[model samples]
Target: MKKNLIMSFVLSTLLVTVLSGCGAASKSTTGTADDTKAPAATTTTKSEKSTTLRIGYQKYGTVNFLKANGELDKALKEKGITIQWTEFPGGPQLLEAMNVGSIDVGHTGEAPPIFAQAAGTPLVYLGHEPASPASEAILIPEKSEIKSVAELKGKKVALNKGSNVHYLLVKQLEKAGLKYEDIQVVFLPPADARAAFEKGSVDAWVIWDPFFSAAETSAKAKILADGKDTVANHEFYLATRNYAENNKETVKIVLDQLAKVDTWSKDHPKELAETLSPQLGIDVPSLERAAKRRAYGIQPIDDALINEQQKIADTFFKLGLIPKEIKVKDAVLPATK
Candidate 1:
């Protein structure tokens, strides 16, 4: 009986040991499964973190329409991405922000980038906006008899130097067979130029956009000449060289969103004007008129575009607006297939 009891105790001890070992093995297997899943979880977290894109834009353009619609922000959010929008007063200011790495992408007219490029600012042309000539013009007061570009030869012409209107003025003068020196050029911001025009301080104003439209309606200014005969007057989408190379995926997203906005602007001109009116503090009627005249599409940056830009650079150089000639091709991003 003593032997049997001892045998029973031994058996009990062995069974307990086996059970504990099995429990530990099961825990080990579970822990390994969890360890394997960690990498995938980490990868997903990294992807989520990369989805935020920063974009910069100015008022008085299709970007405003995009901002008002809010579709882009929603679309990006679904892809685990967020968009941060920043606004500037105009293209020149936006390009300046881009130059300093404050902005990732923005739009500007033909002249601002040329001036920026000549200054050796680090930027790249990502895309082109379709040509819009009617949006920019040289304006004279209603009662003024400045019928031809030549009539303003000796008069002081107000323009934003280094802006697209500057190029327009130069080209128009050249077309009239007059030197840029023949006219007294006054460099003024849009606000100051408007005030000067109202106060009868400026003989003529060469300008663009809502301001041009405003001057035409409110100031009773007559169009001396539109950009039609002289310049392509197309706007450009520019990005910093570093930002574009580092964040191609983000760049593509921004471009795609911009194209969508361009489409919307074309389809809903009146609605766009109403949507933007409150934001810009401009009347809807004027915005509608300006919207009608502007282009609403995107084009890839290519050789033909570059050639057009090169002509602008050459003109600026000849007029001594820029210190040296800049090759537009060198500043353009590589063609995307």
Candidate 2:
């Protein structure tokens, strides 16, 4: 009886030892699984934090307002992203930066993108700026008697080629029942156009923005016609397809911030002018006038807008401004639903 009890106790002890060892092995296996998952979690966290976005803009536009307020940078900083801002003189120059991948996104008037698209640039239109017809016009000296665009025939017309004003000139000529060949086209940038206009080197000058306001105030220029008679004068915001596709969150943040700035500008025109005067080195009143004439808003590039742009492209191609027919819809962002 004593031997049987001792044997039973030994059997029970061995069984308990074997069960405890199995439990410890199971716990070790669980710990190893947890260690394997930890690296994947770390990698996911690092990936979420590794993105940076770059944006490009110009002076005297909605992007400037967004940049000045720092709202975009603030919104992006919350997402563990950084925004790099670059400024250009005009839309053509901005598109130039975009073509070379120096900028991921940019804003420009309707004409620059058409020109770039015609040249086979790989840019996608992300959005459209609110249309403002009064912001663009053809101006002549106040004392001049060139009453109509028809009189511009055989005269040297100063315009920024491939700029928004280029479209204005073309449309105005067509309105007057004249061909583009009827006029002596002199392609001058805004600054040079101003100098030429002031020196009486050009019979007429087509321009936009602070320059238009400056010429109206300082140079006593008379408006031959405004863009209202020609085109809608819409500005476009564009990004590279690769950048926009890869960075959707960043683009949304940017568009949201820009929309906010547009709303703020509409409510506070005088304050906006006061804010921009010193920055642009232009007078407050001039900036104020320009601000009122300028429309500020951000809108997605939809099918309608793309079709309208296509019409402009078609016009340019027919007039030989663009070398070939361009399908504007192809350059719209893929996520443009």
Candidate 3:
């Protein structure tokens, strides 16, 4: 009877062990516990995107307008990226901040990047806006006798050095048969330039809109000559090489956002002006004029465009404006299809 009981107990224990093993196998097949944890970890890794994209912009840039509208911020937020916007009074100052790692991506007129690159900044040209030559010009106070670009020779000319207007001044001087040495170039930011222009200390101010338009509306500044037949005045989107290399998709997204803004602004000039007026602190009329003159489209930097930029760089180097001769192509970030 004792032998019979021992055999019966062993059989019952084997049955329980078998049932537990089957339960564990069923759980594994349905992805419970240990089996379920891996996919969850992978899903989290794929979705938990995180990074900050710092964009540096000048006061009147369209990118700033884009930021104010929150299009870029909204678009980037979905990809687990946040945008940090920093405003600068001028492109040169913006790029100066960039050189010290304070900025990741930014936009500037064609010249600022050239200056920044020549100064050993790791600037990467991502894209460019269509040429907006009519958006910038050499202005004189309406009451001033300086009527043409040629007449300003031997007078004090105010402009931001290493700016788009700087190139305009150079070319305008060449066209007017005046040497750069003939005019006393007063390097000043937009506000100070406006002040000097108003104070009658600076005879002519070379500037870009909406400052260009504001000067005309509020200060009665007259255009000596616009860039229509001179410089291309292409606005450039730039970044550090490091940023462009790591965040390629983010760069593409920024350009895509810019294109959308360009399309909308081109269609709704009045609305664009009204929206930007408060941000720029200029009147709607002035902002409208400025908006109307801007060429609203974004283009990738191509060989021809690179060649154009190279000409600007070479010109600066020849004139002893930039400290060293540099190739614009060296700063360009090649597009990966």
Candidate number with the higher TM-score (1 or 3): 3
Candidate 1 local distance difference test against the native: 0.77
Whose TM-score is greatest here? 3
- lDDT, candidate 3, equals 0.81
Report lDDT (CA) for all predictions. 0.77, 0.77, 0.81
Q: State the lDDT at 284 in candidate 2.
A: 82
- True-vs-predicted CA distance for residue 186, candidate 1, Å: 1.1
| Backbone clashes in model 1, listed as residue pairs | none
Model 3 regions lying over 4 Å from their true place: 1-50
Candidate 2 at residue 295, lDDT? 83
RMSD of 1: 21.1
lDDT tens readout by residue for model 3, 217-322: 9998889999988999999999888778877788889999999888888878789888977866789999888888899788888999999999999999999999
Model 3 TM-score is 0.84
* Model 2 spans with C-alpha error above 4 angstroms: 1-51
Which ten-residue region of model 2 has the weakest summed lDDT? 35-44
Q: What is the alpha-carbon lDDT for the whole of candidate 2?
A: 0.77
Model 1 per-residue lDDT tens digits across residues 115-143? 98998878898887899998999999888
Candidates ranked by TM-score: 3, 2, 1
